[model samples]
Target: MTNPRQPHQPRQLSLNAFLHDTGHHEASWRHPESSAERAHDIEFYVEQAQKAEAAKLDGVFFADIPGLWAATPYRPTAHLEPITRLSAMAARTEKIGLIATASTTFHEPYNLARLFSSLDIISGGRAGWNIVTTQSEAVARNFSLATMPDPAERYARAQEFIDVVTKLWDSWEDDAVLADRDSGRYFDPDKVHAINHVGRFFQVEGALAAPRSPQGRPVYVQAGSSNEGRAFAARNAEAIFTAHQTLGDAQAFYDDIKSRAARFGRDPGHVKILPGISPFLGDTEQEAKELQQYFNELTVPAYGIGQLESLAGISLGHLELDERVPVELFAGSGDVLDNNRSRLQVVANIVERDRPTLRQLLHRLAGGRGHNVVAGTPLQVADIITEWFENGAADGFNVMPPLYPQLLDAFTAGVVPILQERGLFRTEYAGSTLRDHYGLPRPDSLYAATAAATTA
Candidate 1:
């Protein structure tokens, strides 16, 4: 079955709603309608997943962190593990794709591969893995590492990790299972092969414990913006979750990554780049602005300062909140700047363009740092999305709401209708699995084909 909104055709767009626990904004928990306390509740996530499915959105994504951000009163911290949460969501929702973040830096390749492969079978192939090389120092400590490895070192390990995992997934042939009761020989040892991967990061001398999943492999999604990150995505990612503050930046990233795919002998169309967008909605433009301001007012300045200190490598706690961010702080932080190039570039751009005060920077970055934060009516939001999609700036968007359910519902009910009417989004699901939902072909079972050829 073909997706009506397949990208091979003109003017078609794909959308994935990125669901945060309470909301994208750090202070979203303070809102009256926000259910921050329900972050740990399975029912809360299930209801949100159901809503996205009801809206006929393509997928629902969950972002994760191995360690809690420095304890803050301004925002909620930690919740259910993402893979388990997505598994629960899979039970409740039938069609929508379920994507979850898992870091190669923290997880062993064999265990990680098995986990996603199991999820694919459980969800009937509606699972996706958002690969990330976690960068937090705190996360490194939790994993028994002295410190986070340099960016290049992490990417090198990630490449090997993925290689080992993919081989493991391909180890079991599709026809390996033979549940024949009469013969009482429910086995096909010849069909199941062992993966002897001896890479720098991992070495696995056996096949994956599970059978080949429905999709062969879970949909490979990535969310990294550095040079190594982009290269990794170019070679391996089917979907990319990225952040950009402007259309020009988004377009540049889109072109660069697509161009890089050619070198990997990959079809550029196979890599779908979705930038994060957090919408602040209201009845009128003025009301939307006011709502954005309300969230800004609720942001904790100290938390922002701590974040800034981490980013710029300078402690801002001693500085006055009303004062301009010190220029001296950014001068010698080239190493820090290069490490998180995308985010540092965003901060530098904002500093140069807006010259915002320390308090103002906190408000500006209150929602998912520098991702396009727009406040307007649904039609207006749809216009922005349509413009971006049609103009080659985006394949789709990662729909983030400043607050959940309330804001997500507004976008689904209001903006989605406009997009559907414009032929930019889907009105109903056209396929069952996440691969089918994305108009992707199910990968051939390497083991199965090899065994069949050998027998013949």
Candidate 2:
């Protein structure tokens, strides 16, 4: 019989570690325990993956941008390529899911398809692709465009980008390969096909070179919560990484995404929405707050001001740290607080609701770049997660530590056990593949489905 206490089924929460350099806190590198010097060390990342696996967390995510983010000079910006690093991680860890971000704007569909297919195979189906349309204007210029690609145009291209890539991944049927020595035959010619895809933004001849990867294709994960982004995710994403400051905000976004997915003829349960949470855990609430404050105090004011300006697309040089920002300042910024979509809106809500001083606002965003930042004891952190998970606010969370392995260690050791004892999270991994971890089904190959229909 199954262990009576063992975690079971569809009710469990899915957690992923958002592995940023050093930590999520802007001044984490300056922390005494931070491993800042090893920012570029491959083992630094490998260890993180291993640790998450040890805790039986669902996955580890690496978000990327083609060019330097506007605030590069403020923190440790140097890093290894995500796919390359993840491939290395795949070799070291056994069951942890490996998720890496790749831009639809920066790569050709075929090349991107092959890279993820290889990753899925390398990790025995423990791979996920975090699809993104590059948003920063500075990064766009690096690709030779004088300005950022329009969001609509970028997403349109992204739509086609996934279409073509999925076709390539579906090119070879799972059983297409048969190395029959006596029969002197290789893969069944009938089972492999060329896509012959042509679209508004991309045109490509079909037939991916590789056989269908372990999970058919990397599990489609996305992070945008914009009106456009939600539509895209409703049609494609299996998991979504998002930001939220309150339960109401999270619930509204959750309901919208689920409703949209149902409209697209999808099972709403298949689309897992995970908001980002950066926790500062300690023995007591006061200690947790102090820990958060220590990191905040180390941050540079100039960098925070510059970062705020860049992200919100506004000028803040004129505002004093202690003064309340004028509500009208964000009036023209599209849907800042009215809709919970953009980063600016997150800032707007903080300003409108908390009415925080400029310095307070900077410190708030400095922690997770608009993601929720919580400081509490382990039980408090677990309680927050439980409330959100049970109250229709989230399916899971992207766990971002304010500092590196130290914060990760605290979560796995301190918080996870509470979640486990409460039957909210798994104490051990149930399956090997990422899809198994999240309880998402493996998709049938498009070609296979077509052929099965014809036969019927």
Candidate 3:
């Protein structure tokens, strides 16, 4: 006789380790445990992936910027190409999703589709693509553009670019390759088709050269929080990475994006929203706070001021660092449609709410760009995560450690165990694919679904 089981429990939270060279802190390289020079070592990344997998974390993410972020002389700024590196790490670890950031603005649809498809296959369906539109004017110049591409134009192209790529992924049906040896037959020609995709920005005339990947296609991810970004994500993204400083802000964004998805005839519950968090951990609350302060003291005021000026789009070099920044400094500089708008608003919100001095604000931002920074013991950190997960502020978090290996080790070894005890996270991986790790279903091919619907 079959055994009967108890009632099913609710779904668990999804977590990703957002990996950087040393860590998320600006001065992380100076930390005793982190070495900035190890950024390019494949073994370094291999070790991190293994650590995350050992903890049963869902995934590892690599953020990319196509241009120089700052001209700082100190700190490490180098990064390995993500897909190539993920491909290497795929061989070293099992059951951990590998996500890479790729820009739609610079790559052709055909090549990008092939690249991610290859990664999904290489990783046995554990590949995800973080879609972004390159916005830096410096990077634009490298692509032969005399000026920055307008934000509206970039979003429009991105929407169509996604449509074309998804079509390519669906061009070959799962059973297209019969490989009959006795008859000396290969793939069935009728099951394979030409996408013949022609769009405003991209034109392609052939089917994708690869067979269907294990998860059907790589998972789609987005990081932008603008209106256009929300709409695009609603139509396409299965997961979103975002930044917000307060519970209210996070709830609002979560509701807005899910509502947008509903309007697009999608099931909002399928889209996972993960905000970034940089945790400074210790055995006691007081110790955690002290460690956070230590990192802040290491911040170079000049570099911080330079970064602040870049975001505000106004000169602050002449102002006293201890003086309160005038709210007018951000006026007329960023609009909702501009590239700087989202990040600028994050800073403006901080100034308006707390009215901190420039020095104080810089220190607050030094840890995780604009993501919320939490300092506490393991249980305290777990409380914040549980509250967010339970109260609808987030589906999960992009866990960023302020220092490499050590802080990450602290989180997984200390905090994750607490979460597991509370039944808020998984004790073991549920399946092999990245989609399975995220609790997201593999998508059906558009053509196959359409034909089945017609027959029914």
Candidate 4:
């Protein structure tokens, strides 16, 4: 079958509904339409998934922190586990892909493989795993560690973890299972091979318990933007969930990853780069800015301070909210900045660009927490998305609405039609599986492909 995800006449845009509890904004729960209590409500997510499906979005994505993200009392930081939530969404909605975040730093390879494989089967081939090397000392404590592993060590382990998982996924050939009662054999034993994968971080000696999924394996979605992260995504990721504050940075990243993929002997076109976008929409531009400002105004200063402290790796609690933040506080040598890249880079970008006071900086990050926040009318939002897509800055966007099912509703009801009218996005899903949704080909199992080649 021809892969639906391959490039066709029109360059279709890939959009995902990046679902958050109340929403993406730090103070989203304070909105009249939001409720902290509803964050745990399965029905709330189901409604969100259904709405994305209605708009013909490619997928619904959920990001997880594994531990308490920040001061929970100040902000509603509690969240449902991502993979489990996506499973629940799978049953309630069809067509939209279900993508979940899990950490390589904490999860075992075998268990992670089994979990994603099972989800792929259960979701009828609509599963995608957002591979993440979680960066938090707090999360390390939950896993019985005093400090997080260094970046090099963590990425090394992640590479081995993914290698073992992929080998396990490829162990069971597509034709291994046969429900032939008359022959008295349910499966072909010869077709099922033990991986015997021995890696630096993991070892596995058996086939995955689950058979090859409908898409061979769940789509590999990665979310790392550091140097090692970029290299990792180039080798393995089918889709990347990324965050960037500027168009130039996004384009540079897009070019670098594609070139890296080509160097790895992989089709660069197969790897989709999706930057996160938080759209706070209104019928008019001023109205949109004011609505986003309302969420910013609701942010507790203490919460923002704590967040900045983590990013800057310094004690910013002593700083006055109205006073201009000392730029030199976070200014360090090249080696030091490279050590803590993603969040620090984002923070530095904001600081250098605007040189805001502590209070101003908090509001700046309040919208998408470092992702680009576009507060505008429907046309303005659509135009921005189109500009990014057409200019090679992005393959698509992970649409993060500041408020769940409300701002999300606005984006779909308002902005999506403009994309559809311009023929930049799909009006309806042409295929069923998540791979199909992303225009990725269903790959053959390594064993199956190898055996076929040998026989020929």
Ordered from best to worst lDDT, the candidate numbers read: 2, 3, 4, 1
For residues 1-456, what per-residue lDDT tens digits would candidate 2 score against the true structure? 011222444498999999998999999999988899999999999999999999999999998887665545678876678999999999999999999999998899999998999999999998899999977777777788888677788889999999999899999998999998989888899999999998898888978878888888788999887778889999999999999999999999999999999999998988999999999999999999999999999998899988877766679889888888877776755553211238778777888888888899989998999999999999999999999999999999999999999999999999999999999999888788999888887787888999999999
- Model 2: runs farther than 4 Å from truth? 1-10, 334-341
User: The CA-based lDDT of model 1 is what?
Assistant: 0.84
Error of 2 at 386 (Å): 0.3
Per-model clash counts, in order, read: 0, 3, 0, 1
Can you list the residue pairs that collide in candidate 3? Answer: none
Candidate 2, pairs of clashing residues: 195-206, 195-207, 196-206
Give the runs in model 4 whose Cα sits over 4 Å from its true position: 5-8, 333-340
Write model 3 residue lDDT over 154-257, tens digit each, in one string: 99999889998898898888888888998787998877778888779988986899988888989899999876788889989999999989999899889999
Find the candidate with the highest lDDT and give its number.
Answer: 2
Estimate TM-scores for all models: 0.94, 0.96, 0.96, 0.97
